[model samples]
Target: MNIHEYQAQKILKTFGIKVPYSILASNLEETVYAAKKVFKKTKNYICVIKAQIHAGGRGKGGGIKIAKSIDDVYKKSSNILGRRLVTNQTNKKGKLVNKVIISEYVLNSDKEYYVSIFYDRNIYKNIILYSKEGGLEIEDISKKIYFQKIDPYIGLQEFQIRKIAFHLKMKYSAFNNFIKKLYNAYIYSDASLFEINPFLITNDNEILAIDAKVRLDDNAFFRNLSYKEMSDEREYSIIELEAKKAGLNFLKLDGNVACMVNGAGLAMATMDMIKIYGANPANFLDLGGKADSKRIKKGLDLILKDKKVKLILINIFGGIVRCDIVAEGIIKFFEKKNKINLPIIIRLEGTNVNIAKKILNNSKLHYYYVTSLEEAANKIKVLLKNELRCFI
Candidate 1:
């Protein structure tokens, strides 16, 4: 799960990493107060106001502002708080900013660098990426970056640290200590991604992390129970949180076809087929391998909440989950709702498939039943064509 930048900085500080002194504020008055505290603590007049959101590119989205005085801080904080910040990493609608970070603004850094550690599934190893060039335009200079893959069994080697430090032209002793601490933090926190952009070096040779972006592995949340408090509910939509509560994986998308599948792989394939057939997927809904009637109803209810959905596609390759149970859920849903305006296309296979087909046939609901994915795609194509014609 992704946490706000302020939270990431706090985490890094726990690992003995130096970061800019910052305070969190939720309103204009609190922001001014925080700015005063930051300036006093850091002995600096200038402070930075950063909008607290999960996405990056906040600087470009006008979410980061440098304030020279109390009045400037108040003005900048007022503009960021309670605003919807749109960035390249976020959707067009953007994310709402309810809080801001007031930090001491550091100046005259000797050098700026980038450092990040993440697990590479393809190589089945943890990789550390570093670059001498670090800033908002780091993506454009990605070719100049260096990568070092670590052996999980043996951990980060001393030789690897030396290579990175030498490449960046840094003193070996200082770089070794800083990198070792960072690697330890990543392992202990169960972080999937730990990134520091603009890892700063002051004239006095003091190393500091100017910006931090961290994403923890959700599967490891049980071990790191305290991290739960860092979760910001505002980062997610209401329906998304509800799906999480129901133990279903759901992601809303901007399209006409809503998909419900039993597994993540199948869900991806279903969405791909929808796009190939000249349509877009409205959402990615994975019912999982052990879904029952109640869970299926919850998934369907979540799909129906999206007004953009013009069609529903239920594609099940049941192994651990019974297809008949899925059919029962669909029947129960329509029975209670009684009148759904949209069309549903179902493709069921494996684990009582014939029984599921019989159940669906007797349900008396207006749905298109197909035996194969190709047939389902054809049915969806014709229905979407009709929907477009009506719109015309």
Candidate 2:
């Protein structure tokens, strides 16, 4: 649902927002060509080369650089293109940089500010937050700021834009246009979150959105086919992509205990219990309230694909989904694969629980069943301790 900065800039342009003149290029020669074109138009020898990746904090990880000359553009692009970019939001392993955005670099920016519009789930309203202190994380956002909660039914207004601009001490001529353009882009783009970090104010009284980050709502994917094509599979892991294709919600974490649960609520509780028991979850895979044999097999396969998983924990309190059906799927999956030594723990309750326990009891696979959440935690604690012994 997230897109690279160049794509975000395209969306901004569609709404008449001003951004730096730029070109997207995937290779060294293309990068130089893009810079040359920008220099010709803007007559600015200084160009910026940015690594195109989904995650932010790119500047902190050297994914962004300023090229003062054409030679600098080629050199920086070559070093960045094929490298794996690591940022604070991304894992230590980083992501592959397949392309770079070359743009005209602006100079003599008098001030920087942070501006973002996002839905505040706590209050279920869209919130617009901005601060003169730019290039800082949310935690570091300055107390001198503006937080406006707008009703989507009313849309944006001229006064709202003027207020923000006035507070930032922006020039009257440019602020009105900049604010209207950016707000309209957010409204029309079906964006879940839109942010412009370091929205630059140049000495020449021009406003420029220096960096943009946009995330689209997944539920609205059907409405925007163009946005779908902009999605990069390289943003996800192989297992993550496969899990998504299988209609499962999966996230890989830096832990060893693999969690399998029937609902998002239970999945969260299971992960919390794991932490309470002094263990970390390797992944979060929600099977939902419904599961068939194929889904069960796919879930198990996905769990096993994670090499960090030292123990598999299944927690099911069936409501719409029958526990017996889930148990049968689990047994048959292990039976077909003949996986007898894998460590699996289960806690089942509600909806044909008796039959489900019986099915699991008769299976040849090594599955430990518990009666309560506390017992499940204890079991995981014991198993993980023994697992640690093997490596130690």
Candidate 3:
């Protein structure tokens, strides 16, 4: 799960990594007080007011501002707090900023660098991605990045540290210590990604993480209970939160077709088939191995919540989950709702397929049923084409 920058900085500090003195605030008065606290603690007049959100590119989205005085801090914090911050990583609607971090502003840094550690799926090992050029334009200069892979079992090596330090022309002693501590922090935290952009070397020769972005592996949360508190439910939509509670995997998207499938791989294939047939998927919903009546009803309710959804596609390959159970759930849902405005397309195979088909055929609900993937694809193409024709 992704966390705010302030929380990431706090985690870094726990690992003996140096970061700018910062205070978290939720309002104008608190922001002003936090700025005073930072200035006094750091003995610096200038402080930075940064909006706390899960996405990056906050600086370009007017979420980061310089505060030279108490009044400046108040004004800047007022503007950021409660504002919807739109960044490249976020949607057009943007994310709401309920908190801001007021930090000591470092001026005239000797150098700015980008460093990140993440698991490389291709090689099945963790790798360090670093670059001499850092900042907001890192995306444009990605070709300049250097990748160094670390052995999962052996951990980071001394030679790898020296190679990166030499490439960046950094002092060996300081760089070595900083990298080791950072790597340890990443491993200890069970972080999927630990990034420090604009890693600063102050004029006083101190290494500091100016900006931090951390994402922890959700699967590893059992070992790190403290990290669970860092989760912000405000970052997720109500539907997504509900899905999580119901033991389902659901992600909302911007399209017209809502998909409900049994497995992750099949869900992906369903989405691809939708796109290939000249339609877009509205959401990714995985019903898991147990597609019971309650789960099916919950998934359908979640799908209907999105007003953008124009069609519902239920594709289930019943291995452990019975297809008849799924059919019963769909019929029961429509019975309670009395009416469904959107069209439903269902394709069920394996495990009581005949029984499931018989059940669905007897239900009097208006739905298109297909027997094969190829038939489903054709049905989707015709239905979506007809939908567009009606819209036009």
Candidate 4:
């Protein structure tokens, strides 16, 4: 779960970290008003209007603007709000910018740095990575990075914090306090990543986090109700949001084959099989154990929304869910929806398999029923290859 920079900054403030105060604005008038208010408080007319999308490279995308005057704020906000923001990471079509963060701009930082702490899954340990070199080129930045591995089981040790701060050449007293609070907040929030990019040191020797990029662990949402509420639907695709609301596990991928399976383990195995068969999976849609016609139809409908999906593979190994019952759900969906165009390959094993076969056979749809995994795989490869035409 990704949160906007403003949202992350607000959380940082609660942890006793120093951050430039900001107001969330969604329009031109609000932006103007926010600029005026911030200027009044800071006694400085200059402020920054930043786009509130989840992705980075905002500066290059014209998503980050420095407003020198109230007019500048209005003009920049007018151009940004409700416009599509294209960055290095975002698709060329871009993500729509629905809001902006009008914040008091910090001027003339003596130095800028990047610092992040997160669990390193490869080694199963928490790591803190800091670098003086901060920019778009990750490879270059990584080469100059100084890192420290923290024991997740024991948490961040006091000596380890001092060691990192010293390595970064931070001699100030306040920076130490800031690091402690930052570490505390990161652990308590169940954050997957807590990044402070361009964490600057002002001439006055004060530590300030100039940017916040935070991602909280979804599995830990049970302990973070407020964090869950901070979810911005704008960051997600319509189909993705819909799937989540429908209480189904789904993720869109880059492929032509749309897979709908019963269990997560089975869904993964199905995708792996598809790959082995020399075809990529378009999406992962796990229907779970108990699925009715409504749920099945909804899943199918969502999968069909992706135009790249040329085939639908329904793999079900029945135990609690009878094959015949699932087959009924499948038939019910196709009977109502249009575009009975794509070939559907179904491999149903276990209870009532014969009955399920009979139902599908009687449906008179362009369906392929394979009793063996190898047969299903071979059929998928042939159909996928045929549908994919040559340059001619």
Off by over 4 Å in 4: 108-110, 120-123, 135-140, 172-175, 262-280, 288-293, 316-325, 337-339, 347-380, 388-392
Who is ahead in TM-score, 1 or 3?
Answer: 1
Residue 368 Cα positional deviation in candidate 2, in Å, after optimal superposition: 2.8
lDDT of 3 by residue, 312-388 (tens): 88999989999999999998988878556787889999999999999999987778888776677787778777773
**TM-scores vs. true structure, each candidate:** 0.93, 0.90, 0.92, 0.84
lDDT of 2 by residue, 1-392 (tens): 89999999999988887788989998899999999998998987888899999899888899999897889888888889999999998899999999899988877455788889988877877888988778746446557778888788887777787787788777667787777777778877889899998788766666789899999976677887788888888888999899988889898899988988888888999999999989999999999867767788999899888777788888888788888998999888887774434578888899999999888888776678898888988988998788732210
Local distance difference test scores for all models? 0.89, 0.85, 0.89, 0.85
How close to the true structure is residue 279 of candidate 3, measured as C-alpha lDDT? Answer: 81
True-structure RMSD for candidate 1? 2.5
Candidate 1: misplaced stretches above 4 Å? Answer: 108-110, 371-379, 388-392
**Better model by TM-score: candidate 1 vs candidate 4:** 1
TM-score of 1: 0.93
TM-score of 3: 0.92
lDDT per residue as tens, model 1, 190-245 = 99999999897766676889999999988888998989888887888999989988
Instruction: At residue 9, give the lDDT of candidate 4.
Output: 93
What order do candidates take by TM-score, descending? 1, 3, 2, 4
